[model samples]
Target: MRISPAYLKSGILVSTAGVFGSAFLWLLSFKAMAFWMGPEGVGLFSQLRQMAQAATVGATFGGTNSVVQGLAERKDEATRRQFRATAARLVCLSGFAVVLVIAAAAPLLTQFFLASSAPALVATVRWIALAVLLNVGGTYALAVLNGYRSYPYLALAQIAGPAALVMLLGGAGWWHLPPDPQLLSGAFVLCFGVTCLVGAFGVSRLPKLERALRLGALPKAQSRAFVRFAFSNLVAALSTTVALLLVRSWVIEAKGLAFAGLFDAGWTLTFNYTTLFLTACSAIYLPRLTAAVRPEDRRACMLKTAYLVLGAGILVCHAMVLLKEPLIHLLYSSQFQASGEVLMVLVIAVIFRGVSWVYGTLILATRNSRILVVSDVALNLMLLASTRYALDSFGSLQALSWAFVLPNFLYLVFVVEYACLQNRLMCRRDIWPFLLAGTSPLFYLALSGPQWANSGLVTGLSMVVGLGAAGAALLAYKKVVS
Candidate 1:
């Protein structure tokens, strides 16, 4: 099916706005929090969030994403509504239970993460935990909207939480209150509560969802299939989280919380900016891929999405790598400026991850959580191993960054092989565009120092080249399509 101009434009604009808006607000909150709280507090804030999110992913039982995949292919509106509502109901029950567990564990986890648990830290953990529970409905709402291909509403709900949180933080800043982790956590919870309310309202307004409230019992077979898929996905999600928590633990043990904060800061910057493209891809591609049942159709969609995102990622990463130091300094204090080398290396990861998301979405759309688990577990193990060696030997985060790059390369190789062989998708003509786009930033970075990259003349030249290459990749993709 050809993408209509208005539909495509609306999708891009709204989805981009959604991602860009949320990123902006979150980034802004980071800046404000940093200024309000010192680096250590920021570190605590970030750590709490990571832990809370991991827990939420587990507690979700993978219902959020499975809702999308389950509903995507359902041509029956009533059935889709049932699936959506069922997931929402089940996740809410799980969320409440998870909140209780997190609340109980807050004291211990706080001490574990921070080396000493104070009342404030424990309180902060509780607040973030509550936020996670509070936001479950919103999470499922976005998933439902996505399943329906309601990009605009999905985008709206995506930003609603962050936007609300930003306003709260901004108001706090206006009042000149000191930004403690607990206070920031409260803002997170409160704003997210609002976000959940907004999402529920939005979903309530949808046509058939109201009918879901009227339905009594779901089809046993359908419910069984969705729950099974969601459970498998939950394992994958939780496993990745465990791996990440291990990595964070290692970083803190080796370097301390201050450095952990810096590491997270660097990592966060890379993903936040780069994920903008990935977000757009998900909004546009997942439903499309989900609706395509034929193997050829799925493969074709995967390659096209991969090439498009990878091509776009090249230009973005180039600009980001070139501007890394300045961008970090602009967003954060001088304390964060140490991560330039790491960010430079992470540029490659960004490009790789940009494409990986396409492949990942394809895998997810096909409901192959087993592949997702194996690939992810392997990469995480490699990451944990290499990162351990790098930290032990070189004692440098930059070395650790390269360690991540190694596993990710292997991960992408495995992913590409799987996507090609399993789906029988062949796009030899499209491969070069991704390779060229993915490699150009790395080539430039390896040859020049960060100072050279950041210089006015070099930055300008690189931007020009990047824009040209990205534009050409898009043109080439268009040609392939025709």
Candidate 2:
């Protein structure tokens, strides 16, 4: 079940294009929305969107990951088809339940979730319910694609849906359509629904879908196993959602809407950038790891990915730090300059996050979900407590910014220990390469002054130095590994 280099390369390209392109388009749309509707409007939009995303995680109920794992374990086409069908059925039912909850909570969400100043923001919360339903549909289709290893089509759908929404929203904004949160959210719902419809069509082409959809097709025993697997993931997903909501709600309550907007924008930038690389890496690596025959091969692959992603994270962090002032000024209005420092702190979190993610994916592939669930719960609780204290003690937004780093660092340490205990992986040796490669970027950032300088010149130099150092380290690592 090893993936060919050609398939891996194509997957990398498609996944990167999908992640980065969608991120770019969505950021542009948000920028446009900010310009037309103001920071508070964007803040309201962001809050509701986050809530919808968090809710959608519950609706998905871990069915997405279960599908991939189930497909990998199944040898017979009939079994695989049955797994898909059962999973899809559960997804639909769970999504309906979520929709009902959203509808029931809409009034409270409108009044309390939104900032009091923006009374008109209630409509956007309602629209998010529709968007959540569409999102669940899209996730189910994506799960099917992942099960089939249809990476290219999955990536295209990911890019297309968001791209369409951004374009539509930007065009409407340009035409001076009355810019409101509800209007913007409605546009999102429309785009998501269309995307889901398109994806459903693509998924229908797989013969397994028809096979799986037959009534009473799978054995009762297998059906129960599928439910068990999905249920574990559902619990993990729900816990993760609660963790995110706790952090986000704290930011809104403690700081203010304006600070939340800044934090959201900065966090989005850092997360999206890291996701661009990680998504591609995960897409190619996860299935391979799951199907890996030898412990040596699995450890080797995981170590390589960890080093590469860690280096990339460092390079991105340094670049963001170096160009923070100018990039913030250019991409967003002056108000967002406050996001510069926040982005810098977030960049640090991203570095640790990259390491944690690589090992975390390995754990999942190994079917060690219990350990992961425990680790994640602990990390999230620590994050919540620390962030609350930081927010209370420090008057600035750095409280939330700083809170993320410690838990991620702790997770990285735990992951290294777990891998060593489980696989006899040489964490001490493997980690040094990543640490050495990561330092060059930090050094570059430290040496680079924080003064507002010529935006173009500084940014160009930062790009050159950061990329050059990262590229050299990667080449050196390849030579050593080879």
Predicted model with the maximum TM-score: 1
Give Cα-based local distance difference scores for all models: 0.73, 0.71
Model 1 lDDT vs. the true structure? 0.73
TM-score of 1: 0.91
Q: 327-445, model 1: which lDDT tens digit per residue?
A: 88887777788767778778777777776677777678878868867777777788889988988899887887887777877777777767766765564445645566557656676
Candidate 2 residue-wise lDDT, 181-280, digit = tens? 7787787787678768867876877654353455544678988877766776677666766776666667777667777788877887786567646755
TM-score of each: 0.91, 0.89
Off by over 4 Å in 1: 1-5, 173-175, 209-214, 440-465
Candidate 1's displacement at residue 427, Å, is 3.9
Best by lDDT, which number? 1
TM-score of 2: 0.89
Off by over 4 Å in 2: 1-4, 115-119, 208-217, 436-473, 476-482
